[model samples]
Target: MDLHEVCDLIVDCEHKTAPTQAEGYPSIRTPNIGRGYFLLDGVNRVSEETYRSWTRRAEPKPGDLIMAREAPVGNVAMVPAGLRPCLGQRTLLIRPMRSKVFPRYLAYLLIGDQIQNIIHAMTNGVTVPHLNMKDVRSLPLPPLPPLPTQRKIAAILSAYDDLIENNLRRIKILEEMAQNLYREWFVKFRFPGWEKARFVDSPLGKIPEEWEVTTINKVTSYINRGVTPKYDASASSLVVNQKCIRDRKLNLSLARQHKSRVMDDKYVVFGDILINSTGVGTLGRVAQVYEDLNDVTVDTHVSIVRPSNGDGIDFLGLALIDLEPHFESLGAGATGQTELRRDRIGETEIVLPPVKMRKQFSEKVTSLRKLVLNLAARNETLRRTRDLLLPKLISGEVDVSELDIAIPEEAA
Candidate 1:
């Protein structure tokens, strides 16, 4: 089947509008408000004010094609429902006649390498690359399948998304539980024998009788800083940096390679937690090195901790990640850019429980983290399969109609 270029399907498109209801009015300044993204995937929401400011004249519905046009282009995302009227100045809205193409299918087609390459080509500018709308519509769109088939493919992909979303929600619950426990036991002084508890004057002020206030350095036998010699494309080493840690987990999807670095057995493995002792935004961010951690090389921004005989890695990691906001405030200097120094991080104190309590806490949090890791691994696999199948289905490289999406018998 011949691919149908977007140019042929055009019913209408609009760009220029009356400045203050026609008749020249003073130009109103439009702020980006960090509310712009072109090649976005899996973004859930945006601010109502930003949405209103974007779509003052008209509101866009869900399933509309949104393309970034200004300040460097090649960004796209489906306009989700329940959004206040939002418009994009540097973005293009490609609405297909439903009689011709399914909007969701078209949105699916624009993901992965095909759209990535297209965006790269459309980018034009020195400082900031802007996308040309003329070239955007000129780009070819594949001949689409019938409505039922389009919906089927979408359903198959959506199933994977549903599972992934559920797993994300589960992870959130696990983190919250851990934090709530910490707050009750530590901050609110709600141990089993709180009324009978006695305070001790340790290095960390007034900790409970059962608690030992100690610096994190004592909990770990080896505290070392990692390095990346240089960035290299061909190298196979997984180089982790400050940005790799997000929401208390290590995101290895964005993991890159270093030229060459020291490779060792103690490098990174299951349940190893790394802390960002100092950086602009990532100071105090904690990353647990699990799943796909092999031959991993880290950089200076990270501080690696190997738990001593008394502590468990998972317990400490969860604790650190849970208290990241507090750690950031304590470590950060009131300046233009926030930073947490390595020495200052050591100076900052935390109340430590006994070995038995540490292990018990680790058992709960690690089980949760383990569940997250397993789910994450599955999500990664699903993502890769979906990405691989996406282009094939869109470009007609594979017959999507012939594909079988096997739902369980009960589900069916």
Candidate 2:
């Protein structure tokens, strides 16, 4: 059956322009759609009044599948319950015919390679490819299994997703705890025995009398950008890009495989800090490598900062977070692409607490950091398992009917 046959309503957002963040309701755009989840952060907002006015014909409801129609073409995410989001331009809302098709089932089908390939072929655009609504509605959908089987498949996939989501939440909490401690001690100067610590003036600002103000160059043993990756289909090495660093975390999803000859010196190792060195909005972003990434290297746009001695990784990350504004100010460009001045970054002065104190702070957060890394690794494994199972289950190649898989109570 064509998608239009199984879907009750297939509509794109109204062509009307959405208001800026200051004057809008929570609006979702192409970038807001991840593989199977909606990324709320950095999503634009539209006025509630405007949303109601434009969505009069078809309002986005919980369980409706939202797919990017342009600038990306096939990314899909389901609207969660209780979100009255205004569908932004270049996005499509799909309401499945509940009796014949489950919403989650349809969402999973859309992301499967078969449907994705069909959508990709029908997409048309010169610089930025897009899917035409007419073409999308006519796109052929594979024959679906019985509703019970559909539910079972969705339940199994969602279980993995739920575990991954739970781990992500825990990782976020752990990260916040570590960062808060860093701020309280290093930024707010509220470390233990703070009452007796004397104050001293430095080039950057007033800091503890015992702290030394130093440039990043003084603490780092080596600093250099990686080579421009030569992408090879057969390559086993992964190359990190600017997009890989988000919210001070490394997202391997953004990394791509490269065929270039391996250079041991160019490899980003555990404890190495990566900084996006080019492009506006992405420049100056930093993330520490907490895991042992084998055969992984970064592209030229990313600068690798290795601590002189092995202990400054956490301190440098926190310092960079605090001095992000300073780094942003040093960005030089006019064509919407800003490049960070490497010299300025090296010369950026930061307050350095005593070695013993820094070590103490690291020890305090060491377990928290370990937890974050462990959770991230677990999520990666879960993701691989889901991806491996998805196509087989969706294509009916693997039958779950006889399997003794138990669905979570909430999911059931």
TM-scores vs. true structure, each candidate: 0.75, 0.91
> lDDT of each prediction vs. the true structure?
0.60, 0.83
Model 1, 1-412: lDDT tens per residue? 2223431332122354312322221111112211111222222233544445445544566556555565334445555454332443445555655665566666676654676576676563446776555566667554567766776666666576557667767766866777677667666767556788788887757777778777777776656667755888898877788767766778876677877657473377665667776645667777766554568867776777766663566556656666677767755655545656656656556788767766766665666667777777787787777777776766666766766665322111
Put down candidate 2 lDDT per residue, 1-412, tens digits, no spaces: 8999988899888886777556456788888888888888667777767788768869988888889988668888888777788788899889889889878878889988899888877764456788888888988998899877888888889988889999989998998999899999998999998999999888868899999988889998768888888997687889999999877888987799888875788898888888888888888788888888899999989888888875667777667766666766788988677887667778877788898888888889889998999999899999899989999999999998666666543311
Residue 310 in candidate 2, Cα distance off native in Å: 1.8
Best by lDDT: 2
Best-fitting candidate, measured by TM-score?
2
**TM-score, prediction 1:** 0.75
How much is 151 displaced in model 2, in angstroms? 1.6
